[model samples]
Target: MSTPQPQTHQQAAPAPNWQSAPGTSYTSPIPITRTHLGHALTSEWTKIKSVRSTMWTLGVFLLLVVGIGLLVAANTDSNDYADVPYTIPAFFGLILGQICLITLGVLVVSSEYGTGMIRTTFTASPQRHRVLTAKLLIFFVVAFVVSAFAIGFVGLITSGMHGGASDNKWGGTVLMGALYVSLLGVLALAVGSMLRHSAGAITAMLGLVLVPAILPAFLMMSESLRTLGEKMTEYNAPNALAKIFELDSENGGGGSQLVLLVGVTAAAIAGAYALLERRDV
Candidate 1:
């Protein structure tokens, strides 16, 4: 009897339902949410803040702007403020300081390309324009805020040192100067996006900054090109910043400079967007 019972092998019980119906969707235990521009912006902000280059570049910018401004102020008499706004000294520092900002702006995009991380970024976001927009917005805000703070600090200290010399609407000029530098940084960012090479993009930006200032002199020597050179000299980054800081009254006011920069930046940004969509990362 024991041999007969052993011959009847028991069949295993069927497993529980482990698969969903063909037409039904499974709800994941983890929360699933759609991504938006804010998420991309947050991601970009995190990336920008986490990198060492951001700190190094911005720190140098601050050092150049604040240090040189203070040094110039310390050496000059209060009477020097009679002809120009107290903020004039900051202009000298910003000329060099803007190079730091331009480098940072190029790094913002070109660095990702250099490391081949841009592919990962695109894979995660899948929306190229959104990513570019996030980069532009985050970079602009950061550049603007830091620039404004540095310029304002220098302006206040200089004014105090000069016994609040005639105001000359110094507060407004501080904001304008910050905006100008920030836009330049944005333009640099757009250029980086287009070039996708750090050194090349940076070199191009430097040309944009320094060429106009220097080339105009040689062009003016050639009488045929005098008007063209004049326009370039009038609208170059340094001249624009100088006008904004009230250091160059011979040139037109900062408003026209801002307008020219705005137009050029807009065109560059548009071109960047076009290239980003058509080209493979």
Candidate 2:
């Protein structure tokens, strides 16, 4: 061997330790927080409040409720309420205002579908059921609160204008009416979710709210059909609210109307949940 065979040098190979060892767990550098119903509620609240449809719908609701309420109160003499509950005047505005609530309810979910925002909503929160539940809760609460305030304000004004004719039942009647309308709005949301289209859902709800009331009038030609139509008229949305207001013919009373609405709304919500779970975004 050449005496000074160029000093050979060998470097040790690096150990294969960069990979995780067997049975060892790896932690991510990123942090994640668990989401809950509260988050969904917040998201829904923000979405509902930020939309122009909400403003326009609710604005018209307020105008109709307050404007018509005052007008009715101003035109009628307090003595006229001797036989009727003072809260009856609020009915004029609430009947029309309910349309606004229904429109807003449809827009709440249908608008998102129309704009394709639902895809992002599901992407962010894959638990579709939770998202839908949150929407229902938030919308019901908002609708109830706004309606209550409007009805209360109208009742107060009517009472002041006709104190002697006012009845203590005004509170209960107003609360019941508010509940009825809120349920209708919730039903509208469910329909919107099921249809996934704004115009279609709105039309469906309009029919739900209106057709039952009018159909009976035309069906009076047949006795058997008239009976069914009469029942529909008695239990229809407007008549239900009117019963709560103590203005309509007292067939089933407000209690029966509330029960019917609750049943219908519950069924719709269940169907909505089922459809939402099975369908693709």
Candidate 3:
């Protein structure tokens, strides 16, 4: 035959079914449904430790808390300090430590954004809140470890630095400072989750965490600002929390300070989570 005749419409061969293949056409496996908080916590813990900044920031926190405390102790004369109501040097050290806390807090959350690994974290965790919570727990636990040694060593070494102005240190002020840093990490997490930029989040945190402390001095009505300043200072919970640590047991931070910090931290975290849910990942 010169050429095969074209099949008529009725005789046209049936089309092959491409839908069914040797291994059925890939149907994407359903994404894992639930995210376990414990799983997320463990994973986050690993992420924090692996990062270099975590180590460096942590090192600085310990160093300053100890070194400055020691130096302050060695230098200040008891005679001059006796008249001062507050232990200026120790107070100064506490304030300085907050600087380190801010960096440590920022890195804990902001690093994910800086490295673009947060997306991966979200991918694996899927539940944003769970991941965030895990992050908080992990940050706090590590902060606790760091704080234990950092606070204890600083406290003991700086006792002499107190220059006879006695402050037993609050029951948990040292721990509070650590928790504040950790919670600040949570605040950073919220901010970072929203901003997704390390520089911006860190800048925001500096303002959010530090400005209130400095603002008290700059206020126009110094005498009138006593109450207002007290209220505003709580915004910088770390520093306020640090003050609690600087006080003796006779005048510990008491409920008011603790309540103030808890209130502020709760508000910030709540606001952050709400924003996080509404914003694009």
Candidate 4:
């Protein structure tokens, strides 16, 4: 009677759990993989170029960079090189180029907060640290390109102004100048993250980039302070970054890594990363 009642369906059994080796560290969640990092970088780059502000900032930077070089070229008389060390004044663009870099840099992260898109960003990509790394990567890439463009145009325009053959020295300056300008964005982005406010980050950036630039000019007024500050601006500090591209001075007191440069860059980035990942959006 039981055999004739009906055949019952049998279900598959659940899989067994495997245990890990004892005393080994266990991280339930792994970091984002390289593939994810690449995807995030691509996404970030797309986001950067799609914005109108990016275009506007880029346009303005190019204009200022090119404009300053031409102005310096036009103003250069024999007197320009009479007392100063370098023959070409094109490197002068470094000063003006920084403004554009700072503005764009702030917008990079602050813009996200402004539009309330940060939540959307994080929601889509929960691996928050990877997002930051992507932003950093994209910023550097953009900076490198913008720099090449600015330097290339300046060189072409000032070709006849400087008699010194466009040798490796000039090449080095151009490259370094571009890097310093671009890295400013990284610093700005960090501050933007930490303060989570554009105004605060921008103000801090001004304090860092602007103060160091003008300090050298003021130091000239007082011999003792000038000597000490000159040591700071010209070489003994983070201003040495400029030297990598040959922006250092003839007297060896011209430009070293401006102390603020390294400190600002490091502090801003770390603080930003911590605040960004640890806190709620």
Candidate 5:
């Protein structure tokens, strides 16, 4: 009777299949696309244009440049241009307005870090160098364009009103000044990337831009350091821009300033890339 109870046979459970069957394939729901530098450029452009900091900084910059420039041009007498270049007044405004570009440049990269958006940026684009490059390129182009326009406008108005013989050099000087500002901005961007903090990066850039000019004045107390101080004052950012405007007669040509700025910017950019690759987001 016990032996007759049920067939006493149980079907064996099928063994689990860990591998896909031959000739079968699995498809993912997410679509994947290859990313390139253009994608990063577009992303950075969108970021720079969308942010309020960019608008506010650039707006103030334009106001300082154009407004002060016009005021200077209005106050100048035609006789004043006999000894001075028509474009000289533009420097009065540009020296102050250049700070705005430095601020914007720091904000461009540091703001993202401050807000934790950089993590998302890196997530979207894993190539840190590409992201940095895109940021530098976009910021430089925008800054240069805006600066060129502002400086050129001032030069045009002043030249028209004063009608100087050296008006021919206005265009070249404006171009050089704009490039100088743009390179300073790129340097700021590099510093921001290296620091990853808006306030710290901005402070560092301000020191970089202004300290050389100021420190040399105090250092003149020491006769031993007077030469060094003079050199710093001569080669500082303001002096560089002044040289371009033909305001600093003691300094050498703008070519040296441009070369120095380019070399410094290149070094900062290289350091930024190196630090970014080595650090965690």
Candidate 6:
């Protein structure tokens, strides 16, 4: 006969405080949530506002747009606005101010690539398209709002001093001008993303903006290209802005300008997205 088997005591398992969902083996102690575009937007907003370039560029932009506008308004008389909208003076200021916005837009994406911060950005947010979308949205909104405010403020002052014509659609015209400027900035952003370099993208955008306006002049010298040159002059950025502000005599071209800009921006954005996915950060 064998010695009495050693006795063992077994403890009962604790009861579950909460039942796990079907097929879930564990529950996370920390809250788990899916990320969305809103999160990307918040991140982009934080990055953009924290950067010094954004502040500096926008400050110079405001100064140029507002200061030049005031100077032009101060020098002109009520008779100057008799046929044009009170918002016309804003066009002159915005002509120079747009350069600042375009620079800022290029810097938004290119700066990250310059500093290797884009890798970290992508690591934190794996969705590349979302990041690009956020950049586009943030840059567009800031540019549009600032442009509109500066231009609108100038229009208000000029209108107050010179008395706008009763037929002038001051609000609509000013908004349209702001929209055109914002589109230019957005296009610059797309170029920045595609090129991934600040200087190159800035130069390219400057050329795009100024070249069309000037190249058309030279192209007009050749009888063969005079038609194409005329079309370029009609649709170039400066001409578009002038028309939007009612400074140009042309009518019904505003829609065409908007369509052209919108189409170009869209194509640039699409190309940027395609490159961003394929290129190494």
Off by over 4 Å in 6: 1-24, 163-167, 251-253
**Which candidate leads in lDDT?**
1
Task: State the weakest 10-residue window (summed lDDT) of model 1.
Answer: 1-10
Q: lDDT tens digits, residues 29-134, model 2? A: 9998899999999999999999989889989998999899999999999777876677777889998999999999888899989989999999999999999999
> Which residue pairs in model 1 clash with each other?
none
Model 2, runs deviating above 4 Å = 1-17, 20-29
TM-score per prediction, in order, is 0.91, 0.90, 0.70, 0.72, 0.88, 0.89
Clashing pairs in 6: none
Question: After superposition on all CA atoms, what RMSD does each candidate show versus the true structure?
Answer: 3.2, 3.8, 6.2, 8.3, 3.4, 5.5
Q: Which window of 10 residues has the lowest lDDT sum in candidate 2?
A: 162-171
Candidate rank order under lDDT = 1, 6, 2, 5, 4, 3
lDDT agreement of model 2 with the native: 0.89
Off by over 4 Å in 1: 1-25
Winner by lDDT between candidate 5 and candidate 4:
5
Backbone clashes in each candidate structure, one number apiece? Answer: 0, 0, 4, 12, 0, 0
Comparison by TM-score, 1 against 5, better one: 1
Alpha-carbon lDDT of model 1: 0.92
Higher-scoring candidate on TM-score, 1 or 2: 1
Looking at model 6, residue 14 earns an lDDT score of 92
Model 4 bad stretches (over 4 Å): 1-35, 77-87, 160-168, 213-228, 231-248, 251-263
- Tens digits of per-residue lDDT, candidate 3, 1-281, equal 58988987777799987776676666668875655788888898888889888888778776776677667767755564442322234444555665565666666766776777778988887788887777777876777677656655655554545544554433365566555555555566566656667788778877876678778766636777777776675545544554555443344553455566567667777776787677665
lDDT of each: 0.92, 0.89, 0.64, 0.70, 0.88, 0.90
Task: Count clashing residue pairs in model 3.
Answer: 4
Deviation of model 6 at 37, angstroms: 0.4
